[model samples]
Target: MHNTRSSRGIQDLVDLFDCFIVDQFGVLHDGMRPYPGAVDALVMLKRAGKTILVLSNSGRRSAPNEQRLLRLGFQIGSWDYFLSSGEVAWKRLDRLLRERGGAEPLKCLLLARGGDRSAVEGLPLEIVDSGADADIVLLSGSMGDRFDMDHYRRLLEPAAARNVTCICTNPDKIMLTEVGPRFGAGRIAEVYAEMGAPVMRIGKPFPEIYQIAVEMLGHPPAIRTACVGDSIEHDIAGGRRAGLPTVLVGTGILDTLSRAEKAELFRRHGAAPDYFLPAFTW
Candidate 1:
């Protein structure tokens, strides 16, 4: 059994680490606004001279995510760096395209929140109207708030049948919505994979993003850095894999689970956090 200690907030463990890699959604905010005390918690960290990296599984690039946080009342000096899965994936895609000598622009079908095209905004790829015409499907965000599983099935079936590759930048299985948590873009990518389409997921529970985040933080020792988030599968698992300490916040995904259920969840995932916070507070 894992010895996961329960704590009231980040205040109990501030000095243990010099850097914090924090998850944006669920832990810090719920898409629409910052969670109670979240902004203050960040301020506390900043005041303590902690290097904060606001990491996210968001499919939109870093600039938009940073802007959203600012609009939501988070001060600019609270975090040191901000990185998103979409930004990493975009960089990789750009590198690959350059490596290919700019032969031809690949036709891409982008699925994002509210028809947002920021994922492909500055890329050389052509945005195709239909999956049938796409050379690749960019699963950036979920329209789960607007559409259902069947909607995605019909949209991706044609591309899956043709064996078009899917690049899923955000691998979050569920997303926080105004109503509650709903299926995320990763779930849509899973559906495409179930349809026999090739999917390359880039985000939490994956090592690449962590590596980039660490580098952005000037390569702090793993022991001196902690990963904070609400999802065990993504945040906790990814942190463990990246050789950093993990802190699970009860304010987000696991907020509704009973104590016994949470124990079972840790057992099922076979990875547990080192500490648990009631919320993202100072």
Candidate 2:
């Protein structure tokens, strides 16, 4: 039973951990741009001799994310590494490729940003236009900003009927962007599951991505690692499930909620963070 308490900034809790698992979207940026002081926070952690991992649920692979962050004025080299759910998914896809040896590349139906194929750029996977030609369905993101579940149902139901296994790089149901909260790949995957297809989630709230981050931190004990993120269901709950200390940043998905409302939200979800802050900063 963890009681949610507020801290002035990330600096207040700096002494408690040697490694930081930082979420990108809410804590560092809001999709459209980086939050004020977020970049400085990274530099502060680096100066404090702490290992920082930008653990993000972004559907794009780390390379592209790094490039995007650099464009947004974040010092890319300040952190030890940037890890995204797409990279984790690519690993699994790579494994399947190794098992197939000399066979044809696995055909994949990709649902992602039109120009963003970084996740599968060098993989032994072939992007196909239709579900009928696909061996697996890869959902990197929503097709558009609408988040029309009914529209997705029409698209994914056919693939589900074909029993296509779907791998969702980002398991966030809603992306909290500056424009507004929009549907993510997770929601599309949900509809596929309802229509009877196996959905493999590769992001937060799941253990794989956290395991990778932990491994990169030289297998440190859980006590020395703290995960700071904005989403309770995805970040806090996921970190707690992975046995890492969790910190909830109120400036993201929970920005509009009051203290009491936040408490109720955590209770409703049956997950709580060790610490809470109004915003993530040094």
Name the top TM-score candidate.
Answer: 1
Over 41-120, each residue of candidate 2 has an lDDT whose tens digit, in order, gives 88888998989889999788888888888988888578898899998888888887898899988888888855689778
Over 24-52, each residue of candidate 1 has an lDDT whose tens digit, in order, gives 99898998999999999999989998999
**Superposition error at 77 for model 2 (Å):** 2.5
Residue-pair clash count for candidate 1: 0
Candidate with the greatest lDDT versus the true structure: 1
Model 2 score (lDDT): 0.85
Candidate 1's TM-score reads 0.98
Q: How far is 247's C-alpha from truth in model 2 (Å)? A: 0.5
lDDT of 1 at 66: 95
lDDT of 1 at 75: 96
- What TM-score does candidate 2 reach? 0.94
Report, for every candidate in turn, its global Cα lDDT versus the true structure.
0.91, 0.85
